[model samples]
Structure formats: structure tokens, C-alpha cells
Target: MGSVTTTEQDLRARAEEVLSTLAGEDARLREDQWTAIEALVAQHRRALVVQRTGWGKSAVYFVATALLREQGAGPTVIVSPLLALMRNQIDAAIRAGIVAVTVNSANNDEWDAVYADIENGDVDVLLVSPERLNNPDFRDRVLPKLAASAGMLVVDEAHCVSDWGHDFRPDYRRLRTLIVELPSGIPVLATTATANDRVVTDVSEQLDLGTGEQTLVLRGSLDRESLRLAVVPLPTPARRLAWLASKLDEMPGAGIVYTLTVQAAEDVAEFLTERGFAVRSYSGKTAPDERLDAEADLLGNRVKALVATSALGMGFDKPDLGFVVHLGAPASPVAYYQQIGRAGRALERAEVVLLPGREDRDIWAYFASLAFPPEPLVRQTLGVLSDQPLSTASIETRVDLSRTRLEMLLKVLDADGAAKRVKGGWIATGVDWHYDAERHRRVAEARRTEQQAMLDYIATDECRLVFLRRQLDDPDPTPCGRCDTCTGTVWSDDVSADGEAAADERLSRPGVEVPPRKMWPSGMAELGVDVSGKIAAGELAGVGRAIGRLSDIGWGTRLRELLGSEDRPADDVPVPSDVLDAVVRVLAGWGWERRPVGVIGIGSRTRPHQLEHLARRIAEIGRLPLLGTLPPVGEKPGARENSAQRLAAVWGGLDTAALPDLSGVDGPVLLVDDVLDTGWTMTVAARAVRRAGAPEVLPLTLAVDG
Candidate 1:
């Protein structure tokens, strides 16, 4: 016992040496940090650390790695969720005198060298994104060896493993298999800053090695004394934009402005830029090079803000970030807390504001719609997979889900062993799988509850910090003295009249170009359609115009009300005069190379009269001839199907006999429709019109569903 105690002291001394190297000469480990390292290195035990953002969670792992490596252990394996996090960790590890290497989708070419380094025992740590864990080559050829020899395994952002987590990821669930394969007695650590009590319990259970060993759980306070939290409720989208444009200059230092959707991010960035603010937009759609540039700009304080969607969340480390302003509320208080945590990390004070919008719930619902599909859909996807692997594209041809939704479902299926992803693609494993309907329903209910809690946070007069902490089940739920509610200080809700006018003008500016589809969806031949490959350039419809996207922050709200329900009787509604005026504005601003000489109407099964009225009015305004409307075929196509299936449904769905004699037409024809959804409808209809001898077809619509 005396020798054991002396050895622990020696280990502690060695740990302090490494911590000082990582954090400077004066650096010292806190008692909890030392305890965690000791648990992992000395006792060879598993641990779960739930601490605040800047509480040195990474330090614990780095120090543990140093100690374990000194004792001749294999390299640590960190299953990170984001590329940014992995990059930061690798740099930090190198600074701590440890050689850290990573293998992620972004660095595929370097993976071979990284594997060789790990095999040679030159690597002290190996960081991999969770998705890489399931890669066929990595999993089959390398993972078994890595698992057998891994000295320590670390799961960063570990809350993602639980479905109850606000940011649940299916790929993280695959860690369970990796955990089961790890050699017994190997130390494992999972760390997260956003988990509630439920999430902590779930993650702790997942960390168990199944050898009658319990995980050591360490949870710290979720408070941030430097964050001055507040809620700024704005009634309208225009008012919110105006507030941001006029008031952003008053906020301290460079930071981020969060939006709920990609469209919102782009719109906000454009508005701010027009108002002379130095800002850039970041989203999943942003190019990789552009994203890196944007990150650098923000880090260098070259830009006022980065208008971003949730793609900017997690793993972004900016220590002195001065502010975080939410243009819209996240769906849950937990997510909101995580975002705001990005601010005030290395500052004495930082501004954190939430400008809750009325449209936030709508956005939340749209995201919630992408959750795990129903049992029937899951069964259908599994049924389609066989011993012979099929690529995601091929599976998509058979399934109705969008690519994102389909990939998410497949990941979940693969994690559950109902399906397997191979080099070729994904295949069925012939394992019996049961859908956890009750659990999924409960998860859906939990999401709705979280949304309501966010609304409550926005509306409540209670201390915002206390409310958020309570939501996270923090041990000490005390009112933070820095919040607006606690101090009875509210930010000005004023927007300059000029700013409001500028925002209004920007929002009211109608018309977005709707580029025509230039290529046929693959597997069209499998759908029994004769067409395949590139669409003939001359045969395609020319670039057209729409009032706006139905998902846009501008005209979308009004268009949603105008379109109403698809099941609404077509005769019950009349075209709104405002919509007609907007359509006129679209044409007036259309810089077409050649003016259309006539108008053609596409028959709308749901709103034939509206389309006819719209077509006739356009011809009257332009002093052009009005062609007869095309008739609908056997049945209206269902909206929720693959592109190929949709194209097949509409192949002969239009009656060309009703088209007016196009030989007499002198120029291009304007084809009017209520909305443009898959573009297949317009594609098929335009082909029919051109086949009937129209010189060219230009599609026009009230809105486009992006």
C-alpha cells in the first residue's frame, strides 16, 4: 500500500509536468482534473466528464495520454464528431509534446500515412471522426487491430451517443460496437459540456466495458459568469433584420450571428452587407475553401460576424469571442446554451442575446420532420437491401426519401446491425431488427417539449441563466446576477426608421431565377422512361423567374397562406390581387434576352382556375396572345417520391392536343404555374410545349419550393 501510494504521487508529479507544458509554466491541474487523469491512467478505469466549455476537458485527455504513453501504452484513440475539433485537438496535442494524427473525410490522402505512423508506434494519439469508424476499409482492415491495441479511447461530444441528447447523431451510436471490441481493462473516457442528467446517465451506461466495471462520472457546474444573457423579442422578420443591421455595431468585438436555416443565413448576410457591415455567410452548403477563409477572417477579427446556420456549431474554438446573437431561437434550451457557451470563454464579460422570432417554430418543425422515419419506411429500406450491396443513389431510386434523410436512416439501420455498409455500398445483414416505435415516439415528444421550453425561456421573466441551467439539470440552479432579468436591464428594442425601410425594400424585392433542370435523374431507364442522360440544351426550358422561394424569409410567409392546403377545393379560392401584382413585378424586372410573344397555362389538378386566371392576366398585361391550357392526364402525381419516379409519373401526364397551334407564334411562350416543386412538372410540361412547335418555353411561378 505504501509503494502504491508513492507510485500515485510520482504519477501526479509527471502529470503536472505535462500540464505545465500544455498550458504554460504556471499551469496546474485542478483536483477533479487530476482525479480524472489518475482514474484513467493509474486505475485503468472509464470516466465521463461533464464540464463547462473552457474547463480544460481536453487537458485531462492530453495529460492522461502523456502518462499512459510514458508507461508504454499504445496511442490514444479519440472518436471526435467534427473536423474542426479534430484539427484543434491535433494541434494542441502536438504542442503538449505528443504526436497526434487524424483520419477524416477531409484528409483521405493522409490516412495511409497516419495508419503507418500508428503502426510504427510513433503516434501518441489518433483522432477520427465517428463516420470514419464505419468506413468499410477502415473498419474491416484496421479497426480490429486498433481496438486490440488501443491504450485509451476517448469519445468527445459524447452526448451525441444518446437519442435523448439535443444533438443526437446516429454515427455515434456505432461506438457501442467499438467499445465492445476494445481490449478489457483499457481506459475509456467520454466528455461533453451540454449533457443534462438524463444524457449523463445514458452516456455513462454506454461507457461501461461489460466486465462488471462502472464508469467514474464527474459533472461540473454549467454556469458562465462572464456571459451576460438576455432575450430581445422582435415581432416581425423585417424588424429583426433592421434591429441587427442598426444595433450590431454597438456589440463588442467580433462574433457570430446564428440563424435557424441556410436561407436565413444568406438573407441576413446579404442584408448586413448591403448595410455596409463586414460579414460572411457560413453553412453546410458553403464551399470548404470558403468556410476555411471565413473561419480565418473571424479568428483574425477581420469580419464583424459570420451569419451561420447550425453547421457552425460544435468544435469551433474562439477563446476571446465577445458576443453571440441568435437571429432565431434554437429548438431546445440545451442547444441554445451550447451556442451561447461559445462566447465569454476567455473574456471577463461577453454579450449573449437571443432575438426570438415568430417563425422559429416553423423552422423547428421542418427540421423535426427529418427524424427517424416510420417503421414502414425503415422496413422498406431494409427490404430493398440484399446480399449484393447497392449504392445510396440506387437505393434512393427505389426509396422516396431525400438523400439526406435516406443517408440518416441508413446510418441508423447500419448501427443497429439491420444493414451493413460495404465498399460497394450498403447491404442487408439478414439480422432480425425491431423498430423501437415507443422510444421514437417518446423522443418526438421530448423534442416538442424542448421547443416549448425554449419558448418559455424567451417569454419568462425569470433569470435567463437560471432557467437554462435548470433545463440542463445543473446541480446549483441559482439565478445568475449578470442576466438582464436579474439586473432588470433590457436592451433597446428600437430600430431606426431608415434601417427598417432598407430592410423592407430588400424583403419586398421580388423575383429569384429558377434555372431549369439540365440533366435527367439517373436510373430513369429503370423506371421504364425512355429519356436518360443529359437533357438536350435546346430542348430544355430557358431560365425562368419566380416571386420567391416558399422557404424564403421574404415572400414565403405570404405564399404559404396563398397556396393554402393542397386538398382545398380549387374553386373555393380566387387568386389574390397582391399575388397578381407580384407576378407583374416579376415580369417587369425579368431581363429576358427575348420577350415572350404568348402565354401557355399548365393544367393544375388542384387549382386549374387559378392557373388559368394567372395565365390570362399575364397575356392581357403583355398584350400577347393567350394559348389554351394543357389538360391533366390519368392521375395527379404524388409529391413524395424519387425524382425518377416523379419524372415517370409526369412523362405522359400532360395532354399536348390542347396546346394552341405554335407555328403562328412569333417568339418564346410564357408557361404559368402556381408553384415549382421538383421541377419535373415544369420539365415535362415544357418538353410537351416545345414538341408542339413553340420556339421556346419560359416557366413562371408564384413561388419555388427550394
Candidate 2:
């Protein structure tokens, strides 16, 4: 193959030919699409495309690849974000006579074969995920070769590279390094539909490669003409669920029902399916095979809807999707628009509705709490990393962070050159890394602003599309005449009485299993704790029960009201009558082989009275003795600390000597608490009681944080 010089007209014609093949015989390139292709194939310049979904973003890259490969350029290397996106792009590429192969977490076995194809010039395009950019082997071995010989580089979902983006991914930040290392004169394209002005600027700056050249940014209208946006504010979770159960069938066609969490998605899907609707729950927890099957089902219109989270956000291309309904408001209007954009892309009309809940802000706050850790934690993590490589599991033992947060931090550190992930594990690079406190603070403030914007969107009477477009800083914001507000066509908020009763019944029946921690967190020995490996079964608390999760739609609202900080003076208030009754119901329904002979309360610093009342009531109802509460030995750490740190703070904090004579009770003891968040408190308290001669401990709580 030889490099062939082609005029702008020739490149456009070739791009149009590929577009016709990929889309259809009558398909033609949009003006912006041709401009992007011309910049890539004819002028060899960088471009950033911020176009609406179904605006042929993928087509731009596919067409450009066809034209570039015709002139003997290397295969187009696309860094996609999700497996579903990769799969869709590969199929689309093949339709245009482009041989595309993907290397993602799901296809480890095919990597070598894919590499062979790329090396032999049998592949016109190669799709890799952002996370792949930092893989030890891929980064050290494959990336350099691919970067040097790449005809063009593409970053899909490029907004993710900007921390200000609604869905900021640390893995995507590593693309900056890749762009810097790429050979000069090769065209690069960064594309996304959800980036606002800030995200576009951030992503464009990152794509510059220090060339002293401005990126060619092509941004189109954010408005979706075919969407009919509306908000249906239901007063309660039960009402919302009931409304969905009744109104879902009336929606136009097969589409997606978005939820804010996995549990919500599953609950909605189950409720709808029980009501005779064909819907399936799709989340990150969904099995890979099941996800593929679900996507196929929706595409084939075999299922009415897929109740999903952001896991199904980008890369899904369903042209005729008739509706999109959000069960809860997203934290950002930009993100909401991106999700609602999934509908009516190629159709004349699609229904988009948002059912805002009172609990949406609480959910948003919980997720917002997972932002980058403080500097002290980051320093502690780096201090624990030695010259010797430590696996993530091993590092996790020393760092008091959740596995997800730990991995994210490690990725950011690696991208900043402060650490390296190798085959053995991760190693500190000894580079001086400074925490960008101001930047992080700004980002957090931006999140709060976006959240407020989302709230405003739900309350506004103006055009919903116009509000969302304004939030994204669209150059020409205008009212979409099809929206509920614009057309004065409000969706009914009426839920049948029977439907509401059924939903209430589902929410009222509560008892979530609380599984005990089987193993002590690793690296406890370094903290002067003697615990490690599997916990002794005799000392472990049996599978316990909670009235509900703090995040559940059912009892979650009540629990939040009880535990929320609206009234600090009420924190120690006695357990409510309804909660106490629910506790009794949970006990009556408990399937324990040996009923508790005594009830013991875990000492609570903030709500001791609540705990005592709970224990006394349970003992009185079950005809058991009310054992005394465990004595506090020391101050416990804040509730937000990691598991290891939490354990360390509470290791010797429980005094077993305070327990009443347990020798007379040679049976399972019931452990009562006001609430369970980390389970560490329960674990430590149960161990102390068991060691104090209780044969077994059965833990129960009013609420558990999911």
C-alpha cells in the first residue's frame, strides 16, 4: 500500500461512498461530517466534534477511516469507553467494509489475535477502551507501536477526559499522555454529545499535543426536535412506582427506563414485569452474557424496556427508540440530556419523562461523597507503596479505602507519573505529586451548581429542552414546541388506587439480610491488630436482618428522616412506634433455628436511648432477658473512614466486662442497634459479646446503608 495524495473533493466523495454503505444507499454525509473528514484525511488536523446523539458522530470516524486507509494510512485507533459501544462500532465498521477488532476487558483471549491482524494490516480500525491505555503490558508494549504507525486517533466520549464533565473517569485522563506521544502529522478526533462549554474547552486543550495549534471544534445544536420532554412529580416512591406500572404500557414504543441505582433498576423492572410488561433490569452488576442478550432484545423490540443505570449510557445506538423515562433526576442536567437524547434520534416523535423523587438529592449526595480522597489519605497510600510492587489487593490491605476508590486513586496517580502499575502490582514512582486542592474544590462546587440546575429543571415551567440546552451553554437556545410546558400538554400524575396500594405493600414488607464480614481487612497487623484471614466462625455474627436499606425506595425515606441531620436534637430520640413494630414483625418472620434467649444492645454514642429501647422491646416481646449494653472503651473514628481505619478506631473500643452475667444464657443472643452503616460496629460488638460467653449473636438493625 502506498500513500496517495487526494484533493478535498476526492476525500469527501470517498467519505460519502462509505457513509452510503454504512447507513444506507441513500445516506449522505452531513456538512459538518464532511468537514471533519476533510480535516482528518485531506488536511491532517485535529478536530473535536460536539454533536447530538445519532448526529452521525460514529459515521464521521468510520467514513474518515475508509478514506484514510484508502490512501495507505495506518488503521484508525479508537479509544472507546464501554464494551457495548465497542461492539456497536465494530459492527458499524464492518458494514462499511472496514475490518475492525476490539481489545477490551471482556476479550482478553482475542487480544493476541487482534494484535496479529493489526500488525499484518488486515484491520482497518482497532477499538480500545480508555482503561486499556494504562494497562501495564499494553502501555509498555503495544501502545508505542500503535501510536507511531496510527493513521488517525479517535477519542469517543471525550467529555469523560475532563473532570468537569458529568461522568468524569480517571482512566480517560491517561489519553493526554497518549495524545502527546502520538506521531506528528496524524489527525486526531475527539467526539462526545454531552460536553458543555467547560468540558469542550477542557477536552480540546488536552487534545492540543503542545503543538501551538488550536483544535478545530465543530459543535452543533443540542436540541432534539423529535423529543417531547415532560416532568411528572409524584409525591412519594410508591406513587412514582405505581404511576410507572400504569403508564409504561401507554408509552409509544420499546425504549429504556433509566434509574439512578442498581436496586432501583431491579425494583422497577421486577414491578413492571409482574404487571405484565416485558422489561429487564440492566446494570453494572448484570452478567456480560445477559447484558448482550438484553441489548439484543431491546434492539429487536422483544422487550418493552430496559430499566438501567448509567452503565447503559453511551455507545448504545437504537434508532427507533420511542421513549425514555427517568425514575429519578440525574445530578446534572447535561447528563440527563445525554440520557434523554437516546430517544427519538431517528424517529418523528419520542416521549421523554422524568419522575422526580424527594430522595433524589440524598442519593446525589451519597454519590458526591465518593469524590477524590483528601491529601492525607493520598499521602498515606503513597507512603505504603514501596520499591517492591504490591498488588491492588495487597495495597488495599494497608490503605483504608474501598476497592473502587483505591483503584481510581491508583489510576490517577499512575497518569500523573507518581505511580506505575506493573505485572506484579503497583509501585510508587517517587515523583513529587501535589494535590490540586483548588482544582478539586472548584470541581466539587461545579457539581453542586449542576445539581441545583437539575432541581431547577424539574421545577421550571419554561421549555424543558430550552432549560437543558441552556445548562449545556448551547449557542442558540430556543423552546422546543413539542415539550409538555411549551405545548401545554401535561402528562397525568394519576396512579390508580389499586396500583398505589400494591406498590405500598411492596415497599412496606421489609427485611434485608445483613451478611457478616467473614475476614478481617488485610494489613491489620501493621496497625498493631492481631486479626487476619478468615474470622473464627464461633466469633462471627450470624447472618442478620435489617428493616430496610438506607437507599431503598421503601423504608429508606423513613430511615433517612430518622437518621438525617434535619434535627440533631432528635438523633438520640427514642425509636418511633412504627419502627418498633417493624422490628417485632422482622423478629416474628425471622427464620432462626434457635430463638435468641437474651437481647443485648450495642452502645451508641449518638443514639443510646434508641438502642436501649429497641433491645428492651425485643426482649419483652420474645420473653428474653435484656442484657446490658457494651461499654465504650475509647473514642470511635468518624463514620466515613475506610474499613481498616474504622476497625483500628474501634478495635479496643468495646468493653465486654459491662455485660451482665451471660453464663446463665447458653443460647444465641440478639444484638440490637438503631442503624448499621459499615457493619464494623456490629462485628466488633458481636465479637465482644461472644467472647463474653454468649454462645452466638444474632444482629438486627432498623436500617442498613446499601
Candidate 3:
């Protein structure tokens, strides 16, 4: 029944009635669902329900809401994680004749009316994102009143509250204040589909509400009877693409094809469309309206699948989704389980397959780099904070940290009470904060253990389902008899010649626009440099092109070997002929506003031989003059972590005078580099050339290391 439950006989009958309306005419609460609901309604106790997807967890809350409303309970407050889940919860509540309202980032205009309804008891439930709990205005002006008056509290996707959870979020910790402030005798429910014993224990303790009373935790078996798991080993990205281009249409119904990167999702979707399969690309980069349209098409079976990143995972309510295919493995099995759980929720049988690659570890490592920054960086962030609040961007201008990493650090500090987010920005609370190095070290160790566990899952010969469930610490990890190992089934590795050719062609294709930087980094004046606003158009580097991103599945594979991480500094080598051919093709199709008349190479201290060789070949192939290199004045620019610092290092470090005679050149000069990391090096070089009288500047690179 609903989260707001009651023990009265009439209310019990009403809970069933609401369940029927919400689920179906013959629907009733499952035994475990009833057990959790009764503890909340009858005993005013907290409950944690760890059931698999489609276990009718929503039904418990909806039924309880109806029963408790009959006895004059206030509206329930649900802290949900995603917009999709909130929409689904609202629709589900409507089915049970409950008026549910949501207060989230998307519906700012409706907040006044939503709050008014909550005050009038017109809303049966209110759904919100965890981030909303700490919103300056909402936290200080709205939360305390809402918590005091709330009939019940629900934390959906509750695993996020724990640092050990696979997809931990800092804002979810805000639930602690709400839970503690919630009036006594208000039933509370915390729910999730993916959580190990550690995550469960963490979440259970968090939901205990400091009442010295144990929370009732109902954890069911994670086994999904409808899922048939398998692994299709493709040796290369091309082969993986070929398999999908050929095998996707043959799957039972519409589903999701998961990719580790946004570009991969778009690339896969593009190829699938070219193959005449109805599909769409979904990722964090996709526009909000487009995501909605894509979700609608999938729900209506208008598309075969939405090639997506993890952005499309968690709380997407597609009950009949037929399959989930992974282009690369996640860092941990728990995360993989969360993504695939989106499928087979309602079907009697659904396919789950993994097409993992060796490059998966590289991607995993990139993410690992963002994990809690070193103590020095943490202190640097805190040192910048004071009684006067400063926006994150303002602080970024002074620190040598990327925006993403900076935000993560700030959130962690906010949780530790060393800093607090306010209306203006963030300010230091002056709290004596200990680094808690031991706790952070243990968390890091746990993450490494999880990554190793994912590798183990891929190599395991046991039942795939059993292996996955075991990773989540499932109590009953029996063989499912449906996985490839259990059934002695093997997927053929071969692809049709046409499919293979298409894949090879697509992967081989190269070139992506390398848009030039515009505005100067904020707070440059603070660094004893004087620059602000946009870069003058004459000095700006033209929208250039790169052979491909270092993250792409195709050129990315080759580029990694040539330009990625190096164990030790060594000698330079010549450019591969095939890569040179791709660069020629890229230039041929560039269609620049003005053709480049000469080429200038960016000097590299370590890779000068390789850099000069590529530039000379490009100029020769195009029959253009080979201008001298734009020499480096100091040490070469590496991957500078901070925006302001990266710019400062390259500000006056390029020796434009090394380019023998830019005065004689009249056309846009092609400034070639081996790799483009921050794009500041290119920008600084272009500015120097443009000042030296080149009409315009166009940057060309072998790879973009964004």
C-alpha cells in the first residue's frame, strides 16, 4: 500500500482498492510489499525495500498513500533521483486517483502553485530530485516546514545515499537533514533495486532517522527469471559495430544499446540509421526536448533502440524493453546490473549481452582520475573559500583544477561542513575540518576492488546471472539456467561481409570539427595578467578539424597507441602512412571558408621530429609552401589541469618570430600539431601568427585529447 499507511480495517480495504486502481483490477500487494507497508503504517517504522525492478515498489507507496489519506495524513515527500522517474511516479499516482506534484529544476514556474497545493493538502504526494533538497531557497525557507508536516518520507534510488554505492551522489546526503527533521510517527520508506550488503547497511543506517529504532529492511532475491544473459566477444570495434548493424533487427523487440561515451552512442545510432533500422541517440549532451522525443519513440516502439550512455539508465520505466547490449563494460558489476535492470522488467524473456573491449580499462581509468582529489587540491579549494561567498567559476579561475573535478571537490567539502552553498555561491563555515584520509583511502580501495570484480565477471565461466548477482552480494545466487554458460550456448563471432564492410568503412572514416576557444579564462587579472572578454575575431583560431577524437572507437584505437599515455619519455617516430592518408581526406572534405596557402608546425620539445614530418607532408601533398615552425620559448605545454594556468603558461611562450616570414604569407595558414589537449596551445599559437600578419589561422591535429 502507500507510504502513508494505517492499521484501520477500512483503510486496509482501501489500500487494496487503490492497489487495484494503480496496478490493475486483480492486483494485490506482494507478501514482502505488505510486510514493509504494515511496519510503516501500523508501527510508524522506517522500511527499506531492496527488490528488483518491476517488483511493484511503486504500488506499496501508492496504496499506502490512499490508506493513510483516508485517515487524514499529510502529503508524502519523495526524494527521487531522475526526471524520468519523477514523471513516471506522477503518472502512476494519477492512476490511483492521487494528485501528485513535483518540485524540480524543470518546473520552476509551477513551484508557487505546487507549494500552495501542499499547504492546502491538495497534493497526495510531492516528488523532487535530491539536488532540490539543498537548494538555498528551498533548504532555508521550505524544507523544514515540509518535513515537519509531511505524512511520510520516501528515498527512491536510496543506494545513492551511500559513498560505497556504485553511483554515489553527494546531494543524496541532504536526505539526512530531512529524515532527522521529519515529525515522529510519520512512516518512512527508502527503496532501491541495486545495492550490495555494504550499500544496504549504509542506507539503512541513514534512514534510521536517529530514533534509536531499527529500520525494517526487506531485501528480496535479485534473480531476474526473464533475463537471458550472454557475452559476445568481438575482437575489434568494427566487428562489434558489424554485429550490432546485423543482429539488432533480429532481437525480440525495442531496447537499449549502451555505450561508454556520448560520441559512441551517436556513432552507433548513426550507423544503425544508415542500416535502415529505426533508432535514436541519447546522452547527457542531447537536448532536453530531444531526450523526451527519443524516450517517447522507444516507449511507442517507433525506434528499435536508443544507443545511449549511462544517462539513459536508472528509473526509465520501459517494462517490456527486450534487450540491453553493452558496447563496453562498466567499471563495476553493480553498475552494470543497474543499467541492464532497465530491461526484462515485464517480459517473460529478454536478452542481455556484453561486447567488452580492452579499451574499457582506459575509459575506467579516465573516470578514476576524477575520484576525490588529493588533499593538497582539497585544501586549495577550501583556502579560497571564506565568509564572503564566491561562485564556483570565480574559484576555478584561481585553482588548477578542471570544472568537473572542482565541483566534485566542492560537494565533498560541503558534506564535511568546511564549506556551505549559499544564495550567492559557496562560503567557508570556518569549521575545523579533518581530511579523514583513512576514510577516503578505504573508499578508493573499495573502488579498486569493485573494478577488479568487474574484470572477474567478464572472465567468469559460471552462470553470468549468478556471477552478476554474487557481485551484488545476493543472498541466493543460484544458477539461472538462462545464461550462455548455463545453457551451453555460444554466439557466432562471424558477421555478414556487407555488415563487416559497412562497419569497417564507418570506423575508418575520420575527422571531427575542432571548435576554437573564444572567451579568455576568468580571473586572469588576479594572476597579474590583463585579459578579459572574447578573443578578437582576427586573433581567434578558425573552427578547425582533427583526424578524430581520442575517445572514438575507430581512430581512437589507433590514436591511443600513437599519442596516449607513455610510461617513459622516448624518441620520436615518423607518422604512419595510413594516418597521413586520413588527414588528407579530412582536409579534402573540410571546405574551409578560405584555402590555406602555407603550413606552420607547432614546435614540440619531445616530438619535434614527428610533428615536423606530418606538417611537411601535408604542405607537400597540397602543393603549398612549408613555413617554419612556431617554436616553443619555454618547456612544452602538457595537460594543464586548470584553465587559467594552462592559458598563462602558453600566453607568451610561443616564438612566432621562428616562422621565417609570416609577412609574405597572405592566406589562412594551417598550424599543425600532433595532438590538441587544452586547445590553449593552438589558441596561443594562432594569436601569435595572426598578430604577425597572417590573414587567418586554421588549426589541424592528428587527434583531440579532450
| Tens-digit per-residue lDDT, 1-706, candidate 2 | 5564566556667777888899999998888998898888888999999999999999999988988898999999999999999999999988999999999888899999989888999999999999899988999889999999999999999999999999999998788888898888899999999888899999899988666789999999988889999999999999999998888888988999999988888877888887899999999999999999999999999999999999998999999999999999999999999999899888999999999998899899889878999899899999989789998767765777877789999999999989989989999899999999999999999999999999999999998888988888895756889999999999899988999999888777778889998889877887778899988987899999999888887888898788664233346677788887888888889999997888888876766777777788888888988878885667755554467767877888877778876766778998988678778889989888887778889999888987
Q: What's model 1's lDDT at 176?
A: 90
The clash count for each model shown is: 0, 0, 7
- State the weakest 10-residue window (summed lDDT) of model 2: 563-572
RMSD of candidate 3 to the truth, in angstroms, is 2.4
RMSD of each: 2.1, 2.9, 2.4
> Candidate 3: which stretches are off by over 4 Å?
1-9, 566-571, 636-639, 660-664
Cα lDDT of all candidates, in order?
A: 0.88, 0.88, 0.86
lDDT of 1 at 78: 96
Off by over 4 Å in 1: 1-4, 565-572, 661-666
In model 1, what lDDT does residue 575 have? Answer: 78
Question: What's the lDDT for residue 457 in model 1?
Answer: 95
| TM-score versus the correct structure, for each prediction | 0.96, 0.95, 0.96
lDDT of 3 by residue, 1-706 (tens): 6464354565567667788889899987788987777777767789999989889898888787777777788888888998888888999999999999999888999999999888888999999898888789988887888888888888899999998998888888778767877787888999999999999998988888578898898998998999988888889999999998878877889999999988889888898898899999999999988988999999999999999999998779999999999999999999999998998888999999899987898888878877877888788889989899898878977777888888777776776678889998999999988887887899899989988988888888998888888888885767999899999987777898888889999888988999999999877888766888899988899989999988898888788788646453535888989999999999999998789999989988787788889999999999998877887787665556777878887887878767675777878999899888888889889888888888889999999985
